[model samples]
Target: MRSTSRTEAFPAHTPAAAQIFTTVLSHGPLTRSEIAGRTRLSAAAVTKAVRPLIEAGYLVEDADDDARQPSLGRPANPVQVDGGRALFIGVKVTGDELIAVLTDLCCRIRVARHLPLTSRDPGAVLASITALVQELLTEADGFGVAVHGLGIAVSGDVDRAAGVVRYSPFLEWSDVPLAELASLATGLPVTVDNDVRALTVAEQWFGAGVGLSDFAVVTVGAGIGCGLVVHGHVVSGAHGVAGEIGHVAIDPAGPPCHCGNRGCVEAIAADSAIVGRIREVTGIEVADTAEAVDLAHAGNPGAREVYARAGDAIGRGIATVANLLGPERVIISGEGLAAYDLFAEQIREAFAAAAFGSAARCDLQTRPLPFEEWARGAAATAIQSFIRSDTY
Candidate 1:
């Protein structure tokens, strides 16, 4: 395999250089003119940015014999990010486990490690993260690349710029300076972001939302989450809590949420919510989400009803995003799709009914991603950070 594990500091320090590189990363193999057009930078600026990148071997000029369009004497070669230029480590910290991945400059996973987090307290979780990073660093050594950065993704409000996890209900954390601690332990630059937003970064760069100017990624599982990408940029918002559709209230008297709201989408659609509601209705003493799903699949009306209501709430929440942003598409994802057959119709129905006018035309599609994929998303954030892309 081509190894990107040996890269040191990036070749260009200019913000415009990073911007041009990111444009190529997303829409690559373009002529210099195409890069300039996509990034809104002058031809001279694009040339200046691409020069050092290509020389440093971080970007490669392909042998495309056609599509020549440049005033420079060069054959208008297509430039692209060399995927194997550097390695990054991304760890997605959930309530019960730490999922980690090692990826190259293109955010392609080279290795993955899963470690169960016995405790959610910051102290204990940090230890687990350290161990996981050590394991991956050993793996990276074999690839002959130096890992440059680490990205840790958690749920709730995260100040990415400050590298602070302000709130994470699942972990019962507040004001945790996670990035600084992780950097100290792992000896790398660190980034902390909301898990869903991290996944949206991956989607923006490599998945369903590529080439899209506007899109919403709604995640359903232990918690309800949404990542909004508008104008080819992920909306982290000013307070770093822009696309929080999980808290969108659908009913005044339905269920209570950890956010202290009634009938919020998360309160209804989250896995715990469904399990709790099913146990309340079925009285079957279900132990976990798996058992609750099994009961629903076993033709239990009460269990099925819980999923239906959850679906309806999620649908309404997605509709709120559609009505507000009018994105080109709404991607329904996360582990919740495991029960999609039970409530997919309800979600579709509720979204269609709640969406207003032209907003209804927005496409709703399902993309199933396991927890490992979420870890890959975290790695993608690290790549974005290392490249200094403003969009990430």
Candidate 2:
């Protein structure tokens, strides 16, 4: 376990407190007046909520000379999250390994650990997580702070409210009580979330999607995942699944997806599909996505064609999102961006061809966020839960 200075709990545990904290978090180092203004909360309410926060150390008052303003009653100082007051652990469970990190309240990484997994069973995965959390907790010990929460991110259909991994194709898991088990093992509050959604929360607050009211984070890699933020909130469908663009059928006769659907974008454009199709078309016996990317870069006709088809599929999928939501931007991301050079043009062209008139105007930008960012996303979810629970 990592060590840190044990700080007091957040003073305001109410919903209003959470709201005020988040407002300061996203747009912090702002005076209480500024906080009330941005959150649209009355100054009285902000004052009531912030006093305890300052006392608890979850929020701090900045004493910088230049930032001081006399007219603001100079009565209030700018408040920001005390990144060092408490610690949190975030673990991203992948098919092959668990990536864990210890983060401060501001979600900055202090330590990172990667441990390979030999089994995909719930019990086995939990064991790995428990061990990792213990190690991080020990590390937190040195810093003299208590680890406040834990966040785990998994792929597939997850019931966040239930804290269960309802379905995770990558891990071959279903109905796994991951949150309860992790919390039991670590003796800390646990927050479970869909990997993509967790990543979306991070983006909403700290990454490329920041400051955008409506945007989509479309990931292309093992699976084609899309996270939609509508009017500044991530939409989790009633059934706990939303933005499953991978299952979006783009070609009815193109390829078969594991979801038992034909012509799904994932079936046609996912990394596995691209690699497998390249082998069928070129008879080159490609081993993995890297080999396939190399073949395409080497100017092999079949490999290039394979990427073209995947790009076309992605474009159509993106167009569908634009048509449905009318978002202001679509941010393309994920490991598949490594092959973007081979398919960028195709993705753009196909998106243009498929988009409806007005929908086509939304900004289309691509960014490559690594797994570390995804792990940071897990931290974001914990922070969200910590703050949103009171108000929501």
Identify the candidate with maximal lDDT: 1
**Alpha-carbon RMSD, each predicted model:** 3.0, 2.4
Please give the range of 10 consecutive residues that has the lowest summed lDDT in model 2.
Answer: 1-10
Deviation from native of the Cα of residue 331 in model 1, angstroms? 1.0
Each candidate's lDDT (Cα)? 0.87, 0.85
Q: Which 10-residue window of candidate 1 scores lowest in summed lDDT? A: 1-10
lDDT of 1 at 39: 84
Q: After superposition on all CA atoms, how large is the RMSD of candidate 2?
A: 2.4
Off by over 4 Å in 1: 1-8, 64-74, 389-392
- Residues 1-392 of candidate 1 have per-residue lDDT tens digits of 22223236677788888878887887887778888888889888888888989898899998765656645664477888888878889999988899999888888889989999889889999999988988888898898878878888899999999898999999999999998888777777778899999999988888899888999999999999999998888999999999999998889897889999898999999999999999999988999888988999999999999999988898899999999999999988998788999899999999999999999999998999877788888888887777774212
lDDT of 1 at 219: 96
